[model samples]
Target: MSMDELKRRLGQVSDLNAAAGLLSWDQETQMPPEGARVRGLQMATLEGLTHELFTAPRTAELLDAAGTPAGETDAAVVRVARRDFEKATRLPTEFVEEAARARNEAHHAWLDARERSHFATFAPHLGKMIDLARRRADLLGYEDHPYNALLDEYEPGMRSGQVRAVFADLRDRTLPLLRRVTAAGNAADYGVLTRPFSPEAQKAFAWRVAGEAFGLGPAFSRQDESAHPFQTNFSREDVRITTRVEAYWPACLFGTWHETGHAMYERGVAPRWERTPVSAGASLGVHESQSRLFENLLARSRPFWERYLPALAKVAPEVTAGLDADTIYRAVNRVQPSLIRVEADEVTYNFHVMLRFELELALLEGTLRVAELPEAWNAKMHDYLGLTPPDDARGVLQDIHWSAGLIGYFPTYTLGNLLSVQLLEAARRDPEIAAGIERAEYAPLLAWLAEQVHSHGRSLTPAELTERATGRALSADPYVAYLHAKYEDIYGLKAEG
Candidate 1:
């Protein structure tokens, strides 16, 4: 097939993928419980069709012909599309459809189980998903570990061992910092954060702040509430985000900012690249970086509160009436071991990911059983944080990732923590930009991000993108240093305790 033919085919595949996404979104946000079976079939059919289209004999022949030296007309286009084709061609259509159906069903089961606080309800479904996932890894084939096949789905050319190497370094450096902060104790009273704040007001506040404060333009975006806070995009012009609100907690606020960070990255992609291979963030890790960067580095900062707390006070005057900026900032950043992974403090948040990474690795490798997950999760939580959940809702069923067949996705959250700090180090060099945050003007920082990172779309690899934007390789130093500096100042503890 010719280069032009390949491009047209690629556009057709993109349309199918977009349709599948919109259907899944509806299932999650608006579909009735009775619609689950139809939604599953719809999702499976779409995925199978997508897999068939990309893996057809003609598509493979075209990709190979165009990618070869004699037939290569445009090296970049051939390179990107061929890479995708090769990866897609390796998996079976049956596996793809099965995985999609299992994922959609598991997600819905997870919602029900979480609401009922019954891990038993979701256990068998998760077991089937994990089994399907392992089959997927085997079909994809790996030289070292099956988990590598899963990891490549999110971060190409990356292996499980490589992820473990980075995670080990992070754990070593982060644990002591956690100990010191624990010893120093939480320096602020976060009890006020749980006081009554209306859900309607919270939604309104989150939406306004997403645009006005976080640089997420309302022109291309809309915010809605869901069982989980997430951002999904059809294109730069149509990005959608969702968050859940709690009348007695601060989770929705930060979760909104986190999803908005994701929305920003999606919305910031170059318009010229829409519906192509180069249309989004470089990888899941890089995507997570944008979300973490906004959620922690900018939105949770003392300067941010100084500018926005009064506005919050106006909305929930009873909750924030006499609360000053320092008090609120400290409250938002309070470090404590928590049952919910999504609501954890910055210091302990990655620990949650670390546990999931280890557990998923075991589950995929066949060393862990589905029926034993509840016990294993309890033990890990006890070992890691010295606290245990009374039920599965706050334990094994806490995250939406695994039920979505996202086995290797947990590590990216921690990787995002590392990426965000390095990126923030780069962004904070401008004095004017730092002052802009204090004044609640985020355009300078947002523009810097757009210029430095977001404009590239998915044209670069994660390593190349990080190096170009931050002038450093992906590493543990920036994150460790950032945590040391910030927590030491806030909690008055030495790095070594």
Candidate 2:
């Protein structure tokens, strides 16, 4: 099999994947309640077909025959295909189909269970998904634990032990910071965000900021409001993103910017490799780095608010009627425990992931029963955040990830935050990035990321990509340093105990 044949096969697989993704997106966003059954069938068929196509024995043989490491072809293409093939073939076809079907059904079921505020209603489905996920991990094989297998799926070289080390450092440094922020009290008022800002105005304002501050031009991207904010790209030229607006909050603004960060990375992928494995994000962690960088580093920066506040004031006076830029900046960055993971403060967001990671690990290891999840979740939230949710809606059922069988996905969010600061540190040395942020010009930073992170796609490993971009391995130093700097500035207290 030639390189061209390998490319052709991968392209076909990409198309099937895009179709499945679109169907899933539609079911979540726009499909009618009655359409779920049909949507499930459609998703199942697409999943099965995609699995068959990608995992066909011949596809692996062709990928292996494509080229040599030293000289036969572009190493990126062969390397990506071979790597993906190895992982894809590890799980059986039956498990893949069941997992996909279960995910689609679980997503729909979760919507209802969330509305009713009941985790018990969703427990059985979640249990099955967990069982399947454990089987998947066993199939994938791991050195330390089954969770490591799932972790490798998202972060390639990352292992469960590494995440534990990083999460521990984060928890130790962060809890005290949280306590201080709470003890000192919120330095800025968030009343500006609580005013009745219409959803329509918020959407328009979010788009402007996404385009002007994030360089998410519509030619390469489209944004729509959804139950959540997410970025999905099929090709560099045709990226799709969704953001939700809160009728009484400013979180949507930051959320849009976060999703835009993801869109920007997708749009920045090297066009020549579009429709192939090498065209996608290097890894979930690296991908999160782009989103977190924009959401927390650039979008939440004081300078960013300096330029964006005035424009926002014009559209929604409530946001600026009583608040100054410092107040708005402080408000958005306030460190406090929150019920929703997506709305968590930057300083404490990892705590949410840490909580979930602990729970999911227990579930997978068979130490935690599905039926006991709500009690366990409430206890953990109280133990970790010192605040307990009043209902499952705000607790175990808050996120759609678990219902969709995503056990190992939580750590990527924290990893992304860590990488975001690390990359920003690298970008800060360029001078232009700071000047542009001061002027509310994101082109320089976006262009820099494109050259350094997005363009390489999966051509590089997550570690290689981080090193090439930030000149270092993944570490907690940047994230911890960033928290210390930002919180101390906002709360006017040393971030030390």
Candidate 3:
């Protein structure tokens, strides 16, 4: 029961977990329809084995004996390992296997349901997923709201009430801003984006931007296509991301940058902590901050398009024929209500996240039933965005999170959006970082994040990391201000008080 033995045991568990992640990455990206059954069993077995190994009695004994470590890195390793071990030990192996199997099956069911535009086809599977989530929260033990337990899994120490408060403030400010933009009536020419750009050209352009513009290392990182854009890593040296290209101009470009943001953080983690528990991003919220920062603040910036539009024009000359950087920036930033969350413009995207958070909370609390979700979702969309999806594919079934049992995770998208601006503000205060960004040299900015955010990994909580890096706790003010200034300039609307 020594520290060395504990590290060895945990490394094996990490390997198994990584193997399972690889299986999932393939399931979404490359697996055939017939492979679903065997993939489900394979994933379930791997998850069960990893859970058992981590929650074993000897692992507990070693954790107790290790107690604490003198070095900062060792202490972080022990702390994160202890937290994960305690959580894992609370769930039975049977529950672990069942959840894995259900998630796998539900994912396939969702795909089929989405294809057919049928909510009923996915309703039963969704009901089982909801039940599984509630059971998990119960097993984890919550003080006030069961949803808090699930929320804590992704964002440690964040509560449902905290998310509600933040969302409420954001919603109030956003509604008026959205209304103003709508009244302006397409001041920016977005017609250029809708022009036919072949998928082949789109993929090549997206890859170039991801590599050259985003600085995702070609030697260690790669981008592929998937049903949904996501990033996964076996190690920092072997990071992989997938982005979909489906005629929408910004989907492939910004999607690639978003996932690259995730991968770049992984690639930038301290090499010393590789294969250890603390080697990933500090938390899901922090992780999303990187993606949102890159996707919106950088990729969508006028300056970025100024530099990259020529390269893009070479690939999609028809689309970029009359488009300049200013036009492209305003077009991409155009505030239009949309059915798809991923395609929603920055100003309206969090409304999409907020809607999902509310629905998921109600579902977990048993106030909402699975059969009623599609209707509920449509109502909320209309309430928030003044648009209703014509089918389940564009409505309730668009996202893959629920099928994968990722309840209580949507709020982090907004949290990340808020934190992205705060983090950027802090980084910009550093003259060196500011100049680097102005000059389109991202190394300084990336290096600063590595030192301040990425390198620490799970060694610090999100609040602590924010406070240490940004000199304040998380806030919605920066994000709101960013939206107002950027949108007002684009749409030529008067600023709100």
Candidate 4:
């Protein structure tokens, strides 16, 4: 088959996958509870069709014929398409449909269980999801660990052992810092942030931050509400993000910024790669870097609030009564151990990720059972953060990842946190990017990212992209150093050796 024909075929499959994504997005954002059953079937049918189309014998023939790199873009397309084809062919279409249905059912069960703070309601569904995950790992095949097979699904080249090593380094560097910060007590007046902020005012402020502050172009992107804050885009021209707004101030504000980072990355991908296998993020880890960068490094910075807090006060004057940029900055960065991962302080966030990664490894390895997940979760929370969740909702059911069949995905979050600082440090070395950040004019910084990171899409692996952009391979040093500097100054603690 010719390259043109191959592109057309692959584009069709991509379209079907995007359609499935739209359905899933709607189910989460707009669909009523009664629609869950039909929505599950709809999603399953779309996924099964996409799987069959991509894994057909014809795709293999075309992938083989589309040999050697014609150019950089074609090379990426062929390379990514070949990898995807091999992976997809390993699983049967029935398994694809079954997994989709299972995920949908499990998501609903998790929602109900979490609402009631009942683990028993969700346990059976979790067990089913775990079984499916194991089956997927077996199908994908792995050398050293079954979790490695699942990890490669999200991170491409990453393995379980590498994630373990990185987490070990992070734990070593962070625990003492956490202890110091905790002993010092609340460094900032976080009570100012807990004041009742109306949802309407919060929505307006979040939109302003996402649209004006973050440069999520209004023409192509939009914001909505969901049970869990998320970003989804069918194409570069139509990106959508959602954030859950509550009485809390930080929920909507930072959540919108986080999703904006994800959407902006989607929007920044080169238009030429649209509708192709390589058009999306290079990997989930790289994608998470954008979100964590915007949410923590940028949104929580003193400079960010200096520019935006005045505008925010205009929107929600009640909450900003005694609050200033400095107070808000310190409040947002306050080092308090929290039950919810999404609301965790920057200093303690990775401990949450680390806990989840370990539990996921155990679950995949059959060392941990779904029935015992609540007890295990509470134990880890106490061990890592020194607090126990009062209920299962705050504990095992806090996140939607396990319910959605997103196994082996937690590590990418910490990986993203690490990469976020590395990328920011590298960008600071460039005078133009530094000036843009200093002036709160983010275009230069965004452009640098577009050119250096986003445009390449899957043209390079995550490690290769890190090296290309940062002048070194991935490491925990940049992230650790960043945390130590930021937290020590905030808490007035002595510098680390």
TM-scores of the models, in the order given? 0.96, 0.97, 0.98, 0.99
The per-model lDDT (C-alpha) reads: 0.84, 0.84, 0.89, 0.90
Compare candidates 2 and 3 on lDDT and give the better one.
3
**RMSD of candidate 1 to true structure, Å:** 2.1
- For model 1, where is the 10-residue window of minimal lDDT? 68-77
User: lDDT tens string, model 2, 1-497?
Assistant: 47778788889999999888788767656788999887887888888899899999879878778756564236778788888888888877777888888887888778889999988789889998899889898888888789999988888899888899999989998888788878988687766657888888888888888887777887777777666567777677878888787755656887888888888888888887778888888888998999888888887888888888899889988668977788889887877788889988887799899999999899999999999999999998899889899999989898888887888999998899898888888887988887886776878888898999988888889999888888899888988988888888889996465
Q: How does model 3 fare in lDDT?
A: 0.89
RMSD of every candidate to native, in Å, equals 2.1, 1.6, 1.1, 1.0
Cα lDDT tens digits, model 3, 1-497, are 49889889878987998999999988988888899999999999999999998999999999889889887888889999999988988999999999999999999999899889998999999999999999999999998999999999999999999999999999998888998889988866778777899988887887887777667877997778887789999988889999888777788878888898899889888987887788898889999999998998988887888888888888888988877888888888878999999888998999999999999989988899989999999999999999989989999999989989999999988899999999999999999989877766677888888899998878899999999999999989999999999999889988877
The runs of at least 3 residues in candidate 2 whose Cα sits more than 4 Å from the true structure, single-residue gaps closed, are: 69-73, 495-497
Comparison by lDDT, 2 against 4, better one: 4
lDDT of 1 by residue, 1-497 (tens): 37678778777888899899888778768888899988899999999998898788888777766754443224545667777777787788987888888898898899999999999999989999888878878877887888888888788777888888887887788888888888987788778888888898888887788878876777788887788888888878888898998754578888999999999998888776677777778889899999998999888898889888878988889789668999888888999999998899888998898889889988987788988898998999888888998988889998888789888888888888889988888887899887786787888988888888887776788888899988988888988888889889899775554
Candidate 2 — which pairs collide? none
In candidate 3, position 456 carries an lDDT of 85
Alpha carbon lDDT at 415, candidate 3:
92
**lDDT comparing candidate 1 with the true structure:** 0.84
Clashing pairs in 3: none
